[model samples]
Target: MKREHIETMISQEVERIISGTDLELVDVEYVREKNWYLRVFIDKEGGVDLEDCQAVSEKLSKVLDEKDPIQENYLLEVSSPGLDRILKKDKDFVRYAGRTVDIHFFQPYNGKKDLVADLVGKGEDGKLTVRVDGNEEILDMKTISQVRLHIDF
Candidate 1:
């Protein structure tokens, strides 16, 4: 089956499995590096522990075994997105607003290709507004190569 279809099917199953739980489904990715991998990213307000990952993995494994969604053998991984997780959706932007983030760009913007700033919010034109050096700047989301949470150690 196509990877997208596989992801969709698994996503639906995950949603069903996590229905009554505090776990929130973040993303489902089916990819092949040296071997195929079915990775499920889950999250909640505080965080998820190893028990959470193991439980989801076991339950999803059972469903996948019964359905046989993917043709090839793959490793199934269930885990949290972590402290510096990438922000991929509009909801992510909204959720993480007021947090510090590292924004990457394909080319230079304001003479720099990357920036570390506070995420203000999503702008009217679908751009991301951020505060840099106390100045608010609106950036086109298209130019953003990546946006990840930034924490100072």
Candidate 2:
């Protein structure tokens, strides 16, 4: 099977396994470094603890072993997406509203390719409205290439 397909399958299985639990499936990746790694990113309201990771790892491991989804040697790891997680889904956009975000645009907007501001949430048209310099800047979603939580020290 294709790598992406494998990842999707693994993600579906993990989602099912963690359903009703506090854990939420963030992202999944099956990549090769020195060895193939099947990394699953998970999260929760307060944050995921080691026990949560262990529970997910153990259950997902059992399912993967039984299903034999990937026909190769790989290491399965379950963990959090970390502090600066990228806002990939609609839920993320909603969840992180009112927080600072760094938006990378495909083309320069008002002579700038990137903007850092407070997320004002998504509009009905899917445009992202952010608070920039005390003003609301509505951005077309298509023009945006990436959006991540901006971490400041």
Which structure among the candidates has the greatest TM-score? 1
lDDT of 1 by residue, 65-138 (tens): 89886889999999999999989878898999999999999999889998999999986688899999999999
lDDT of each residue in 77-144, candidate 2, tens digit only: 99999898878788999999999999999999999999999999987798999999999988999999
Question: How high is the CA lDDT of each candidate model?
Answer: 0.92, 0.93
What TM-score against the true fold does each predicted structure earn?
A: 0.89, 0.87
Cα lDDT over the full model 2: 0.93
Clashes of each: 0, 0
The positional error of residue 130 in candidate 2, measured at the CA in angstroms, is 1.1
The segments of candidate 1 whose C-alpha lies over 4 angstroms from its true place after superposition are: none
lDDT, model 2, position 120 = 93
